[model samples]
Target: MQFESVSESRLSFVVCFIAAFVGCAPLLQAQTEPAAPHTFFRVKAAETLTAPVSGRLLLFLKPGSGDKEVSIDEFHPTATYVAAQEIHDLEPGEEVEVNADQLAFPKAFSELNGGLYEVQAVLDTDHNYNYAGRAPEDWISNVMALAGWKPGSTAEPELVLDHHPEEDAQRKAAYEKLKGTATADVARLEEFESPALTRFWGRPTKVRAWVILPPDYVKSGGKYPTVYWTHGFGGEIDSALVSGLRIYERMKAGKMPPMIWVMLDESCPQGTHEFADSVNDGPWGTALTAEFIPWLEKKYRMDARRDGRFVQGHSSGGWASLQLEVNYPKVFGGTWSTSPDPSDFHDFTGIDLYADHANVYHRPDGSAYPIMRDKGQVLATAEQFTRLEQVLGPYGGQMTSFDWVFSPKSVSGAPEAMFDRVTGDVDPKVVAYWQEHWDLAHVVSTHWADRGADLKGRIHVYVGTADTFYLDGAAHKFDAVLKGLGADAHFTYIPDRTHFDLYGVGDDRQGLFDEIGQQMWDVARPGKSWKNRQ
Candidate 1:
């Protein structure tokens, strides 16, 4: 069970993002009088801009033969061909090229299929496309039609960033819909000014959350134990409301016992952070334990003691809840984490960092490593995920987010990456730093004699045997470590489940959560027998 586990609009040169078969990029052979010009997509910032704009430039390409607009999104089934070029100043009317030689994912221009395509370019003005996607100030180019574009074609397609993408009205409408789902007094979206975070970011940073009170909250005149929740990567404050509405509906229907749910927003421009206090990510742990919790207790009838505040989450939020339960054992009652990220680094999405000459993208047999799977079928590779992140920009992608949460701050004042994005070589120094500070298995084993008493029986983890991201390997290792230490922790690996559907194991869709709610209720209200009124 051994485990070694972003600044302003700064420039980051993500080199050669295409992995494994990067050499497959076509080379122009000398057969004709003039070598065919390499296929490329040219992008330019608008001339109407008042000042210089600098950030990661992204190009999205999709099939243009259909009437339906090509939707560009993350984690698509048929991965899109994306290319990135970091540009600075990008003086008005000037062009920056994302050629076949630049960083790309799945395929570069020279490797994409020959066809008519719709190509659009986005200037991530604040370098926050991973979090906010195409935000308000982000300069986006209109989709330009490319006819008969082929690998190594002499034709060059161009996109002009003369306008911004449409505002996120759908997201806003969804938020409004969620608010309407419950009574105005029952749910609230609140923002807290964290003294710790404000100082760390050198700005008035606020922690936003959706607090859903119980149905009987005002009428009961009694305190309620709280379930603190958060989301994984690509989630924001709006996501908290969606979760809150679901919780509220369940409580109103009496499918589950009523308890206050505090859906925390852990998403940051730098990534999920997982609420780990880091040199680069700031003291989010301290902000939660010392500042946010106490503030919540006073404002509401919250049973804010360790036994009454239970933490639960999925994926990155799952890791955050587990860390909170471990680090501040006296502050949280317990944790019910589902399909969390790499809890043990020995099988970090299936790569051992401690192994000699560790490589994330390949094995000693010269085979590419698979990062995602479903129904025993490989869906994506580790190389694809990392390369895609490199194309998405440096800060908010899952791999770099782990860096922000786990690694030591580099000389440039940014969180150092644990591995090279281009080479796939694990950084020994960063791994060593991660093991000491963030590796949960090691942290529990090393401090068992000192902190085991408070932590025993407080940790509960649920993962799937067929996790999409190979997270089950780490969970198994960490579970073994816990048993070896004689720590009374609960770890469950549901058979035939993946990361997305671990909770629907039993007859009920949310049977496991009901059990968790029952357990927390018993701790908060001893001998009360507060079962679901189903």
Candidate 2:
């Protein structure tokens, strides 16, 4: 391109400026130069004839051009960059433009480093990106590998949502095959309307579970003890069925006890209710104990006595079972909760809510608070995790789930946030409410004077010393309070264990169940072993 005649000094100044900032794109594009081309993605549904789709449109950008699919993985410390926008009734074969001008996780689209990136698009029809996470009817695009992609200088990606996992004939056939192999009792996904919850929400609400009967339940013709188990997080009725199938397999192989396993689902739209009766999430605990338990006992050959009922779970479910045992000691015989959520408010996932000017994002020294870690390595900080959750459409992330369960209802009819979403500032009023209502350690310490006899010898908690969410610190605090009360509760911290591997003992990944089951069995049959209990 030939330049028009210009002064020699002005031409020299331009050459000098270009030389000074040759590699800097922003600085090189000075006011004197023309603006750079804008970049955006064109996402569309497949050409195969189909109805219009409605959901939150998401674009995922991974940092490499490998074969690895760029999926939604907000929990990972170095997760893929994700930007989301809500789309309504998008027709098939119709293109829609998307950019990171709205909300994105970790960083925006334009700010992403220039490199090889694997891009993908998804349409979450259920508005449950935080919970369901690409479940049934969700549309997904094939992975598009881009080379030397920069924000504005290069051509952007164009993706097609061609895959629907829910409509996959192979997946549907596989699920049916599994169900066909299992007994009717083990295969059924039990669901019933929850009266207490319905009354609270002014809408029909139902509770669900997969009640996996003992292998010889039909042959024995005898009532058996029930073990109420709950999945940690991101678990629903279908996932519960998969887990129950594993338990059924173990029971059929005679590796597990003959007790009926009730796999409860704790996930709700507001996040995991954790079966806690809450103002925001509804009366899940009340509905479970008052309505579901009685109905379950009648329909199945379960021992109706409280002593024959045991509760146990992992992670959030762990905390739920612990709360049930503490809150309604007369209903449950015992609890073998493992790797429970923060049992003590004083150390809620490493944040001291009671401390002066407490902040979830940063400590007093201005260091960021780590929310997740593995093998002593900080995986994600509080700010990063929470901010990513904010970008994930707000309902089902772990932190928002906590607010629904722990915080009181605000004037706006939403759960009063315990901490600021962006600033991480903790609210003393909310923490005070959480301590009195939800904090197991605080509730037990304060109410032990009245309910000491009932809770004695009934509470049993196990957690890893190296918990992924820094839950061990809160467990230690919970243990101290129980010890001070001279409560007969047992708190075990398995050395070098993590949240995922706590149940494993050597080659037996589920050996802990046998041990926990035996202890509960002995309580039911005072002097007999598990072999003789049935």
Instruction: List the global CA lDDT of all models.
Output: 0.78, 0.81
Give the poorly placed runs of model 1, Cα more than 4 Å off: 1-37, 44-54, 67-78, 88-100, 151-154, 167-174, 182-184, 505-511, 531-534
lDDT (tens digit, per residue) of candidate 2 on 413-468: 99999998766789999999999999999899889877888888898999889888
Off by over 4 Å in 2: 1-39, 45-49, 66-68, 165-176, 185-187, 532-534
Per-residue C-alpha lDDT of model 1 across residues 1-534, encoded as one tens digit per residue:
000001111011122233224562432122224634556777777889777788888877777754222334444524567777888998888887777445666665675667787777888888877665778888888777767877665556778888777866897887787678766568877788999999999998877788899888887888989999978777888778887787777777776678999999998877886777989889999988898888888999998788999999988888889888888888898998888888888878888888898878778665788887779987777777677767777778777888888999989988888987766778999999999988899898888888898888888899889888888898888899999988888988888888778878367666667667777887788887544332
User: Which candidate comes out best when scored by TM-score?
Assistant: 2
Clashing pairs in 1: none
Candidate 2 — which pairs collide? none
* Candidate 1's TM-score: 0.87
Candidate 2 has its poorest 10 consecutive residues by lDDT at: 1-10
Candidate 2 lDDT at 5 equals 6
